[model samples]
Target: RKDIAVIPYEPRYQSAFKALNEEWITAHWEMEEPDHKALDHPQEYILDKGGHIFIALYRDEPVGVCALCKKDDPEHEYELAKLAVSPGVQGKGIGVLLCRTVISKAKELGCKKIFLESNTLLRPAIRLYRKLGFKEIPKSHPAYERVDIQMELVID
Candidate 1:
């Protein structure tokens, strides 16, 4: 097993962050826009909103990332977003490790539930969510317009 460490996002990870977004769009979203610019926009907003971004490093190399957005509602919930793993390092269980870490962090934050939006094109990721105990939920968010699936997990 690789030595995996989760750290908050820092300026140093800009390149790795861009790479992950580019790979995800090229492989799954089929978007032609520059992922770095598109991703950086939201990254800025999330950081400003008390959101937590975690980067997973394996052997000192950035391999994956996940984020938890603090909820605005009084429900004491959160939203998990921007989950990405280096294409070269995928299937090595890094994604799962990142996800488990995010979930644990959310629970520690006293979140009652967590939600996420994902595209149906990503079959493996959808499966991973199910395996992690996330269940399908109604697509009510305006952001769901670009997403094909929405899921939620109740944190105990």
Candidate 2:
């Protein structure tokens, strides 16, 4: 775990972000427009909109990624999304590191809550979210067709 480094978005690793996310998404669920918009141009959809993306590097190679997407709401919430880890490095604590980094970043942004939309098909991911203190919440109007469950973590 000490060898893994979680860093902010960099132009050089843009492809790695898309590739890492697409790996899991395409394998389990079909890619939606929201995925394309975020993965194709992270700067336009995330960074410029006051959101943040974190990438996990293992031995100087990209292995995981997570994004905290700002919501245009009065509550000042962010959607913790696009969490993915390389197939080869699955269950190696990379996802937890990326998520913790995003949670910290959300707090730094003064966010009131962090929510996420996911599908029931990914049981492991759901468990991870729960372990991170995310509780199941009523599903909102999801942006992607794949979302079946919603969870939220109130930032204190």
Candidate 3:
């Protein structure tokens, strides 16, 4: 309870979101193509589409962010995207808290399943996903050509 808070995205968090993306790219996606515009646009879209976006705060300072995107598929699924914790605070429990928050938010949204894509380079994150009850699934997303692993969780 040490002043960790998760709140919806706001315009004021653009800088923090950018910082998080930079950290994530540097740490886990060094070989992948960097599409700055694509990265920047999703935060705006998530905020505008009534999607759930959460930022973790430590004593009022932004330290992490996560978002849930409603899938267009008729299966009533969701996508968990952009879950990032500050590089400076990586080992703490903030990432776990952020994930739990997203799962709860997904359940609240009536999502029966949730999916995410990750590269194999992110060993820590992959382990975290497994620990959180996510299971590896066959890759089916067309937009994620570089993803080495796909995971899904049944929320219902």
Candidate 4:
């Protein structure tokens, strides 16, 4: 992880976010409408809506990305969406770095909890979420057809 750096989303990194996510999502499931909404217009869908995205740079090149999409939950929660690490560098701890960045940003934004929708087929990602202290939660009505399990992490 020496060369890894987690930085806030910028317009310049938008393509990286979209491409990285598309790569992973397409590998397992077809791109859904929700995916295009965020990936295509991150500025409007995420940043302008008071959400945040983070990109992991390996030696200054974007290799992974994650987002905390603002949600309507009255409990002040955010949806942790669109996490992806380039396959070439999988298992290098970049995902953990990106997630930690999201958790920190949620605290900074005074969020009560962070949640995500993911499919059970993604064993590695599910494991990572558990390792990051996200516990299994009742699956919500997901926006994507692929989500089978939902998890959440309560923030202090």
Candidate 5:
């Protein structure tokens, strides 16, 4: 992970972000409407809405991505979504780096909490979330049907 650095999304890495996320989403389940909306227009869907997307670069090569999307809720909650690491370098702590960086970014932006939705089939991701201090919460109106579990980390 020495050479890997997580940085904010840039126009140059737009396609890479979409590709990385599409690979994983399609691998597990078909892309949903929400996926299309976010992936197709990250700037408008995320950044323009007061959200943040961070990209992981290894020696200048795009390899991972994570987004903290501002939610429509009353309380200042952000949705941690679209986290994907390249398959070629899965266990190099890239995903952990992205998660930790995004969480820190959320706190700096005065976020009260960060929430995420994931399916039970993605146990590794769930474990990572828990390790990052996110606790499971009762499901509400999930964006996708694949989301069977919802978690949130209070930015204390």
Candidate 6:
């Protein structure tokens, strides 16, 4: 975690975000319409809509990316989406840094909860979510067909 930092999304990091996410999406499942929208237009589809995206940089190079997408839930929930760390550095705890950043940002924004929809194939990601205190919830209609499990973390 040395020299690694999580920073707010910037237009300059657009390509890095897209590349990082696309690598994982294509590896696990075909890129869906929702994935295309979010990855291609993070500024408009996410940030402009009151959501936030964070990028993890190791020694100033973008290595991972995550997003907190605002949702319509009246309880003020944010969907934690598009988390991906480069394959070369998978076990290096970059994802943890990103998740911690999201939690801090969500609480700072006064969000009541954070949720995510993911597929079972990503066992590592699921485990990370569980370790971060996200409990599994009944699966709901999600944007992507790949999502078989939904999890949420309530912010107190």
Give, for candidate 3, the lowest lDDT window spanning 10 residues.
Answer: 30-39
Highest lDDT against the true fold, candidate: 5
- lDDT (Cα atoms) of all candidates against the true structure: 0.78, 0.90, 0.77, 0.90, 0.92, 0.91
Candidate 6 lDDT over 89-113, as tens digits, reads 8899999899989988999998878
Clash pairs detected, candidate 1: none
- Give the runs in model 3 whose Cα sits over 4 Å from its true position: 28-38
Give residue 57's error in model 5 in angstroms. Answer: 0.5
Residue 37, candidate 5: how far off, in angstroms? 0.9
Ranking by lDDT: 5, 6, 4, 2, 1, 3
Structure candidate 4, residue pairs in collision: none
What would the TM-score be for candidate 3 when compared with the true structure? 0.86
Clash count, candidate 4 = 0
lDDT of 3 at 6: 81
Worst 10 residues of 5 by lDDT: 70-79
lDDT per residue as tens, model 2, 26-46: 998888888999999999999
lDDT by residue (9-114, candidate 3, tens digit) is 7778877876786787766455233335435765556656657778899889999988787667775367777788987778877888888899999988777888
Better candidate number, 1 or 4, judged by lDDT: 4
Q: 16-97, model 1: which lDDT tens digit per residue?
A: 7767866786665554333343366545666677777788898999989887877686644688877899877788888888
RMSD of each: 2.7, 1.0, 2.4, 1.0, 0.9, 1.0
Candidate 6 runs further than 4 Å off: none
Candidate 1: 10-residue stretch with minimal lDDT: 29-38
Off by over 4 Å in 5: none
